[model samples]
Target: MAMYALTEVTKRFTKGRKEVRALDGVDLTVADGDWLAIQGPTGHGKTTLLQLLGALDRPSSGSVLFDGDDLARLSERRLAGVRARSFGFVFQFFNLIPTLTAQENVETALVPLKVSAASRRERAGRALADVGLADRSGHLPAELSGGQQQRVAIARALVTEPAVLLADEPTGNLDEDTRDEIIALLEGLWKDRGLTLITVTHDSTVARRAPRIAWISKGKVSLRKDDRRAARSRAVTTEPKDADSAAVGGAVATAEQSAAPVTTTEPRDAGGTAPGGRVALPEEATAAE
Candidate 1:
C-alpha cells in the first residue's frame, strides 16, 4: 500500500469573501522511501497540498490517508501527536527561534515527545552534527549565516526521527553554493536514513534531484516526467508569461508520462517565506495561503 494517499481531495478557503479552491479533486499516492517533488507556481495549491500531506490541514471534501488511516477523522489531540511523532517539516524560512542556540532549537522538537533532558540534548547534538553543524550548536540564529541557520532548522526537523520529511523550498533562501550544499545534505539524509522525502519546490535544480516529479496547477495534481534537460532548455528560451501559461496547460495530460517544461526563475514570495512556516491547522492555513 502507498505510505500516504490523497483520494479526490478538495480544499477550499475564504479569501476576502471569495471562496478560493486551493485543491480540487487532487489524487496523489506517495510510496514508502520515495523522494517526491511537487512543483508549480505560487498560489497554485502547492503549499496547500503540502499542508494536507503533512496532516496540518484536512481536505474539504475528501480523504487524506496515512498508512490507510484517515487524518480527517482523527481528533485534534491525536492529530497533533501524529504530527509530532511521524513528520518533520523544514520551511523555506529557517523558522528558528531567535534566542535559542542551534542545539536548543533542535531540542524543542523533543519536548512534545516527552524525551528526557539528557536524551534530548544528546539527540540534538547528533542531529546537528549530521547536518555539519556540530561546532555551531551553541550559536544563536543571528550568530550564524543563512546557510548555517537553515542547517540548524534541518537538524531540528531531524531530532524527532520522523519517518517523513516535508521540505518546502528547502534551498530557496540560499546562494547557489550554499543551496547546493543544503541539497546535498538533504539528499544524503534521505538516502542514509531511509526517509520518505516530500519537497515542494520551484527551483528546477532542487526538483530534478527527486526521482518522481508531480505538478500541481489549478488545484489538480498529476505526475510528470523528471527531465532536467527539457526544464533547463525551457528556462532559457521561454518568456515568463508564456511559460506560465504553458506550464498550466502542458502538464495536465491524462497519460502522465509526458514531461512538462519547468521554469527556473519562479517569482519568490515576499519575506522569503512560504504561506505556512511549519505545522499549520486548517483555519491557520487559510490565512497563511
Candidate 2:
C-alpha cells in the first residue's frame, strides 16, 4: 500500500466574503521511500499540497490517508502527534531560532516528544554531525553563514528521525553553489535514511533529481514525464493553442506548463547527507486557499 494517498481531496479557504479553492479534486499516491518532487508555477497549489501531505492543514473535502490512517478523521491532538512522530519539515527560509546554538536548535525538535535532556542532546549532536555541522554546533545563527545556518535547520528537522521529510522550496534562498550543495545533501539523505522525501520547488535545477515528478496546476495534479527523451517528444508535439495559456502570474512559459521547467546542473561529487528547507512566504498559504 502507498504510504500516503490522497483521494479527490480539496481545500477551500474563506476570508471575509472571499472564498478560494486551493486544491480541486486532487488525487495522488506516494510509496514508501519514494523521492517525489511536487512542482508548478506560483499560486498553483504546490505548497498547499505539501501542507496537506505533511498534516499541517486539513482538506475541505475528500480524504488524505497516511499509512492507511485518514488524517481528516484525526483529532487535532492526534494529528499533532502524527506530525511530530511521523514527519519532518523544512522550509524556504531557515527559520532557525536566532538566540540558540545549532545544537540547541536541533534539540528543540525533541522537546515535543518529551525526550529526556541527555537523550535529546545526544540525538541532536548525531544529527548535526550527520549534516557536517558538528563543529558549528556551538555557534548561534548570527555567527553562521547562510549555508551553515541552513545546515542547522536541516539538522533540526532530522533530529526527530521522521519517516517522511517534507521540504518546501528548500533551495530558494541560497546562491547557485549553495543550492546545489543543499540538493545533493537532500538526495543523499533520501537514499541513505530511507525517507519518503517530498519537495515542492520552482527551481528546474532541483526538480530533475527526483525519480518521480507530480505537476500541480489549477489545484490539480498530474504525473510528469521524467525521462528527458519522452519530455522532449511531448514538447515538440504540444498544441500551438496551449502556448498563451501556459504562462501565468509573470512566470516563464514552458511546453509542459503543468510541470516545472527541468534544467540541468553541473555534476556534484559531494556524498554527505543534510536536511534543509524553510517555510514559504506567508502569502503562499492564503494564496493556495
Candidate 3:
C-alpha cells in the first residue's frame, strides 16, 4: 500500500506584505516498507515535506492521503491521536528530557499510549538496550554521553511502535564517529522493525544509505527510485570525532552551524528529531519523542 500520497500540496507564510511560499505545488508518494532518504540542496522543501507528513502543518492547497486517510480533514484532537499512535520521530540532536532519567525520558513517549508505567519502563529499558544504552538508563541526561543521550531519544521514538518512522537529520549533532554509529543503528532499526522510514538530510553519508531518494526543490518534490548504487558505492560512513565539550550541545547544536551551501545540518535543537529541513524552515517543534 502507498503510505503517503501528496497532490499539488502548497505551503505559504506571509511576512508583512511579502508572502513566502515555502512549498510549491508538489505531488509525491511513499510506499509501505520503504526506506527513503529525502535529499536536496538547501532551500528545497525537505523539512516542509516532513512537516506535512507528520500532520504538523496543513498544506495551503492540495491533499495528502496517508494510508487512505486525508490528513487535511482531520480534527486537531484526531490529528494528535494519529501522530501519537501512527508515527514516531527522531530529532537530530538527542532531545532527552533533562529532568528525567534515561528510562523516564524514553517512557514519556509511551505515556499517551496508556500502557502501564511498569510496562513503559520495561519497554523503554529494552528500547535503550536496542540502541546500546542499556547500562545508562538509570542515569540522567547530565550523566550520559552525547551518543547515549541520543540513543535514549531513539528508544523513546521506537517505544511507540509507530507504522512510520520519520527522522530529521538524525545524525546532525554528533561527531563523525557517533554519527556513523547512529546511522548504523537506524539501518538496524529499519531492518529489524520493518519500518516505513523517511529521513531528511543534506549529508551524502546518510543519504547514501537509503535505497531510494526523493529530491525536493522550491517546495516541490521530484522522486527518484531504487538508488542501489549509492547504497553500494557509499558504504563507508562520514564523521570526524565527538567534540570535547558540551558547548557544542547547547544553542550551537541546532541553533547555528548549518553545513555548507549544499550541505545541510540535521536540526535537533527543538527536541523534535526531524528539525533541519530544506523545503521550509523547520517546523515549530512540538513534543519530544
TM-score of every candidate relative to the true structure = 0.80, 0.79, 0.78
Q: Say which prediction, candidate 1 or candidate 2, comes out ahead on TM-score.
A: 1
Question: How high is the CA lDDT of each candidate model?
Answer: 0.79, 0.77, 0.73
lDDT of 3 at 48: 72
Model 3 global lDDT (CA atoms, 0 to 1): 0.73
lDDT of 1 by residue, 71-150 (tens): 97899899898999999988887788898899999998898899999999999999999999999989999999999998
Q: Which stretches of candidate 1 lie over 4 Å from their true place?
A: 226-289
Give one digit per residue, the lDDT tens place, for model 2 in 198-257: 998888789887767877765767777443333333334444456554443214224334
- Candidate 3 per-residue lDDT, tens place, 217-252, comes to 555566554643333323333342565444444433
Clashing pairs in 1: none
Superposition-based RMSD of candidate 1 using all C-alpha atoms, in angstroms: 10.0
For candidate 1, what is the TM-score?
0.80
Considering lDDT, where higher is better, how would the candidates rank from best to worst?
1, 2, 3
Top-lDDT structure, candidate number = 1
* Cα RMSD, model 3: 11.5
Superposed by TM-score, candidate 3 places the C-alpha of residue 1 at a distance from the truth, in angstroms, of: 1.7
